[model samples]
Target chain A: MAARILIAEDEPYIVESLRFLLGREGHSVESVNDGAAVQARLETYKPDLLILDIMLPEMTGFEVLRRVRESEITKALPVLVLSAKGQESDQQRMADLAANDFVMKPFSNRDLINRVTALLPAKTLAGSGQAPAAVEAPMSSDRE
Target chain B: MAEISTGQRIRELRQHRGIAQSLLAEQVDISPSYLNLIEKDKRKIGGALLHRLAQRLEVSPAQLSGVEDASLVRDLVDIARVLSFDGLDEAIAGRLVAQAPDWGQAMVTLFQRYKDASETATALSDRLSQDPQLRELSHAVLTQISSIRSFAEILKDVPDLPQDERAHFSGIIASQADRLGLSAREMIALLEGNPGDEIERSQAASAVHEVEDLVNAQRNHLPHFETAADDLRRRILAAHGEGSITAAMLAHLETKHDVEVRQVEGDAFEGLVEEGVHLVDLAAPRTATRFDIARRLMAMELREEIEELARNDRLSGEDARQVARRAFANYAAGALLFPYVPFLEAAEHYRYDMDRLAQRFDGSFEQIAHRLTTLRRPGAEGIPFAYLRSDPAGNISKPYSLPGLRMPRLGGACPLWAVYAAFAEPHKTVAQFAAMPTGERFLFVARRVAKGAQAAGAAPAAYSIMLACEASYANRLVYGDPFTGGREATVTPVGFTCRTCSRQNCGQRAQAGILQRA
Candidate 1:
């Protein structure tokens, strides 16, 4: 469906695999490692889905999620958090923080693709906020 | 060289087999007396007998000849130095080897667990302290993660993302995974036991200690300085020493010594000498203020002698200058309060109780401890004492140890010391019979001082001051009451530093040092 996905992660290999799988599934991918940069990228890239890693420079994923949920522009942004810590308290905190989906790292490509597709389908990429109305309809039908 | 001896190993295995020594000697084709002699280390057995004995004992000759569990005993000694007063001596070792050998092994195993735990604790205490390897790995992980994500995004978002570009992205992920793995391994290995190169030296402390040594080298006594200090003491007492040595004493200083004393505003120093007028911090404690004036008066009276004594000191030019400036001044300040003879008599009377002595002299615990270390009067010497100061984060600021037991110049000290535990209970004096790795026991005492808040919103300054004297003199100290029973008395074992410690299984050990395997 050619969905635009923004991945916020620090580990490059996980991001690479996720990007490849998402690209194959017909989604456009943009990634920023700095958690603080997520908001700016959200307004500019306007990705349909945000894949966030828990540990990041300057700001952490949990901090980014709190801000995203509060801000008007990124309030409805579906965020899939990635973490290597995998502590129960961390998971519970993410859940309490209202992350849409959380995947523990070393995540498989299949797991990432599935969560990503559920958050932003190929067709919804246009409506996910940047593409024009004229292009949205054709991209939706082009998926079949 | 071997941690365990072949004879000890044979004794252990034979004891485990539960066979009579006579029967075992018959099987090994050696006389019972000869076997007994070999077991007791009175006879040397060559490789031929070593193999035959190994065969009879159903154990490998390597297990017998190699530095086996004897290394375990060395570690046990190291660990015991932290936990108790005694160790597995020759008699006990012989019994443990011949009767219940597992006891020794069990102790060794227990020590290893302790070593591991101590390491974990000290590492956590030093969390904010930087580890270069950790920082590097963290950076690498962040970079690799970013690269992997970026390359994958390129392959995903860009349509007809060239097949070559796709291949490149795949290769990066593969390469980065290896990089990440390497980074992870290094960080993990560091955590497992490596004490990396982050231990820093405090130049300020060494400079101060250099001055301390200059004073100490003279047996911490200055007869000429003492004579001059005595005269000043008599004069001050005759004039104003009947009352507390207060800031008001400046009137006498200006008239008698022709020195002007003035109060100032600043945190740069407790007091400073400016153009012969003594500018002291008005906000400082009254006791400290009095000490400063004493120093200034002493300096003015004994300038030539102080310079000559400092010049005679065996220190570098800069260090000698520092000593010349501080040693006499600090000595006068302290001597004015404690006054050697009375301080020593009071210390003996009070059993070196810093609190009681401090109250008697109207001084701080630190002031008392500092004075306690300097009681080396020729014929009537007090217990030879050493002092150590550290914070909860494992930073040792100032340390003094008796000759032959130089505490590690860097790091907080053995985590197992009661001084560390004293931090958990501030303002309380905690005592322990602590042994060095050499098994030389000492009566150790530590008290945590909460220096009160700097500002209303800020937390108070915290520190642990530990003092100790050789256990041989333990009877003279009331702190040694617990170990009065005999040589069988137990004591807490500790190391100079983790890196220098041979105790292998100390749970509190933060790093695996050269003595790691032992």
Candidate 2:
């Protein structure tokens, strides 16, 4: 489905790849390096899905997710946390923070696309009928 | 619990029954002086004498021996040690427990709380400060891998990528690989225990904790040292003009006390006194040199006073006493450099601008920061500020906090503190309003200060010093100028440490709070 996504990651290389990949998936992408800017951009950019990084400066993705869930306007904003801290406790904490999905660092390209597509608002998916082939392309080959 | 002699127990029972010492001795068929010695635990009693004493006191022989109260006394003494209740030996513990078992049980519950809180703090400190190298290395490696993986997948999946784009992604992957290799090597080195011996570090930490407890017990103020420092400062100002206090101190040391001052190249000891020569680090800043000289002067002029203060009853053992001696000397030096009334007046006048006070007093950033903590004079006090200094790696030293604000005794503080943030912007003051779980808010001011002169390529030795005072007193400091309204949202909720803090749903929480129910 075509949607707007915000990538709240610090690494330029990761952001660049995500921008390119998500752009190809027919999603408009905006990126910020730190957590505070994520909150600031959420109001203006208003991305359908937020890709959060856990180790962001100023605030962690966990804190951003918490505030996102608390505010009335952005309470239901779908969040997909991309993190290097992939411990069981972190996963539980992200779940408690109401993150829609979690993709660990050194992630497979196909897996990330699938999660992103799945986390986008169901209304967008219903309107668009189905996601792009890039979303499912890695699913079959990722098994190999 | 303390062990009580059977004779002592008999005497206590007799006293409880309102029997005179001579009457009890006569009833027990012993001389009064002999009974006195026995009551003092100097003489032993058993067999027929023990039975007779027990009968006269209306108790059994075993009760007279205090065998039933042995465990209670042990627990009381243990509790006393944990609470830092000075001089609570087994003898006193026995007396307290024997006299009132209900009060003894109350003490046991109090000790339980103290034990739980201390355990949580110690566990959190160990988790955060211990093996920091490993945590850093692992995070670095993972970050590098994430970058590498994204770029590599882009290269592999996007066969139709442009030439320049492909080259950029490839270059990034190569560099990230290099960094990953370096991180892996560092992690291996850390696993091999190359950093330091754990046992030695923990032993030193306990001694440091003892000294901190002693200082904290005294409210971080010593009037005796303050008086001597004031007198010495007057003598220095009178004998040698304030134009050069260091030179004047040197003259004072040399002429009055036959001591020689020498400065050697490179950073070493701040001031190492061997024989009659005082070797000061040549690379040390003027502030440190002057402070060291002042401390040396204090040691020379008031050695007896310093020694007496170091013998504080609160200090546990000789090691803690030795640490206290150095701490007391440093406190004396801070008082000498920044005399109580003048420093407090300047601090109030300047609204506690540390840099301005540093310039006014010719003190370093750290010297000024520490001096600010010693402003607890009755009826003439500045803001009561808690002081903490953390290295880049997050190990905190010389942590002092007010009553409501708890400071970690052994290791690093919570990662959410501005002290950690201060490292990101070296030399720039970072201030924040942090609220603890206890609903206490503090305005914390932090800045990274260089420790000593850096040798080329050797990692710069620096630490961030943070001073925190109650938020209510924020209006008195320049750092709190912008946040005078005390906006609730602007206050960042923080914790003492992860294990001890009971804040719920905190994203940065490292461990479940000990207070939380399963």
Candidate 3:
């Protein structure tokens, strides 16, 4: 499956990693640095999955998510809250704001890809996973 | 944090694992030249190629990208802020992060202990230097000892040592010993650091925190004070006040409330005392006199309510209670001078032009700026602003702030903040769009408020006041009118303070962030 993803983050280095990982995974990706810009572009990009960081300029990721949940169009948009603030309270706030997933900072690339892959709709999976999926599918069936 | 070159990281990882370059390169399916290029930072590697190398090297991609060991950089930054590392500057710290991360962590740990020890010593010394007469007595004893030494030298040089002269010298030596031993009992008590200023500093710090909590809990508004100020204004207007606050309002207080306002210089009398009212330096410029008058009025008229608020708030210490009382009086003064509802309306209408608003209200720029922070009235709310005041000497006087915004607590704020710069241009305001280290942008503005008049003998007290809000709120502010929505062009970067701020590129940073270690 292939999906258009938008990463709302400020750190250039982290942005590069996400871009490379998602691009290699065959997902179309775009990014915005500031919090307000995230909301502005969410509708315009209409990304299937939104990866957002909490600490952003102009506004915060929480503020962006609040707007996303309130808007008619972006209400059901699959949003993942990424933050350096990894406390339970922070996660709860993100969950309360209706984020689909939460990713902690200094995240493992493998863990991040897996989470992103899981969050996106199955129909959006890239063709590269098809052969592996087919093999795994038969194996699971045989076990059953 | 400065990034460690990919080559250096690879080399460190390889050496640590005892793997040869050619063996590693062949295993990763890269030419030895390519490996060398990556090692020397002559080649940029990312995505597939970087991951391929990471797999063969048995390291995470984050290790290659300077992400996994980023905390080491942060630790180095922190250590640098606290203590000096002559051989380990930022670049060297980055190298250490890539090559020897455990060493960096050790440095951070050691520095933390060292800093704690230093602060304890400072506090001890501060507490010991308290007694006055002890210093005078110590100096007298030292002088007496020096005189005795001189007399002994003269007696040694004299060829005809007379018996009477020897007796005289002996008598002087005896007196010297007597003087030295006389203050010996008193000197024992002066053997420790002075805690006087330390206690006062702690009290001031705690008091500010207490008030901040109170302000934050109330959503930055005081409705009762607002209502009371409004009532006072209506009463004054009903009385047909005709002049500045000192003339009309003071007269009204004197005639109606039987409260006389008197100016007394060289005295600590502020707010109100038993003799009706006694204010120190009543003729100061801008709104100091007006504020003094307003504070006195609030102290007299609303003493019961202020006391009740303080009592109910449950502040334990006398210092905190005194600070809270003064805070309430000042709040009432600001509210009385600039009534909330109209001020908010004017703020909105003028886009929060502090000077214009100050002129309109007959107050100082600092007054209007401070008053702006208090407009948290629920239905008629003003812009959420973080206000701060720092004197020319870099001492922060007012540090009222919200959650995202923190006023610098240790080693002063970043020198880059407009508030510090305002001292260079007295009575002038500087407007800017600043970004915090966290990438949160602010509509920052600062102005130097010169108190007192231009008299030959009077040296006016001068300090700078600064106010800021989130950049998105800039459209609602005239200060940010020029920059508008985009802040890229005029973004002056700053951080909270040296020890804690994580900004890597800030030139004014005295110390590194906690994560940036040696």
**TM-scores of the candidates in the order shown:** 0.46, 0.50, 0.49
**Compared with the true structure, what per-residue lDDT tens digits does model 2 show for residues B1-518?**
43556766766777788999998889778899998998888988765686678778876554576543664565565444333344556777676676776566544543333333223223333332355555445546566776765675575467699999887887887676656656644554455444345433333554576677557656688777899888887887788776576777898899899899988865455445478888877767778788888888887787887787678654545766778778888898898888899999999999999999999999988899898998876567789899998988887789887655655544467889999999999869999999888888899999998876454655658899999989999999999987788577788899887755788888887766555643
Q: DockQ ranking from best to worst?
A: 2, 1, 3
In model 2, which regions exceed 4 Å deviation? Answer: A1-144, B1-202, B267-274
lDDT of 1 at B224: 56
- Please list, in the order the candidates appear, how each scores on TM-score for chain B only: 0.56, 0.62, 0.61
Candidate 3 per-residue lDDT, tens place, B224-303, comes to 88898889877876676544545656876787678776665533454346865555464556477788888878777789
Residue B58, model 3: lDDT of 76
Task: Give the alpha carbon lDDT tens digit for every residue of B139-158 in model 1.
Answer: 45444544544453354345
For model 2, how does the per-residue alpha-carbon lDDT over A31-104 read when each residue is reduced to its tens digit?
99998887779888777878887777788778888888777667777778875542435566778777777787
Report the C-alpha displacement of residue A143, candidate 1, in angstroms. Answer: 39
Q: After superposition, how far is residue B281 of candidate 2 from its true place, in Å?
A: 1.5
Model 3 CAPRI rating: incorrect
Error of 3 at B328 (Å): 0.3
Give DockQ for candidates 1 onward, in order: 0.08, 0.25, 0.00
- For candidate 2, what is the TM-score? 0.50
The candidate with the higher TM-score, 1 or 2, is 2
Best by lDDT: 2
Which candidate order results from sorting by lDDT in descending order? Answer: 2, 3, 1
Docking category for candidate 2? Answer: acceptable
> Which candidate, 1 or 3, has the higher DockQ?
1
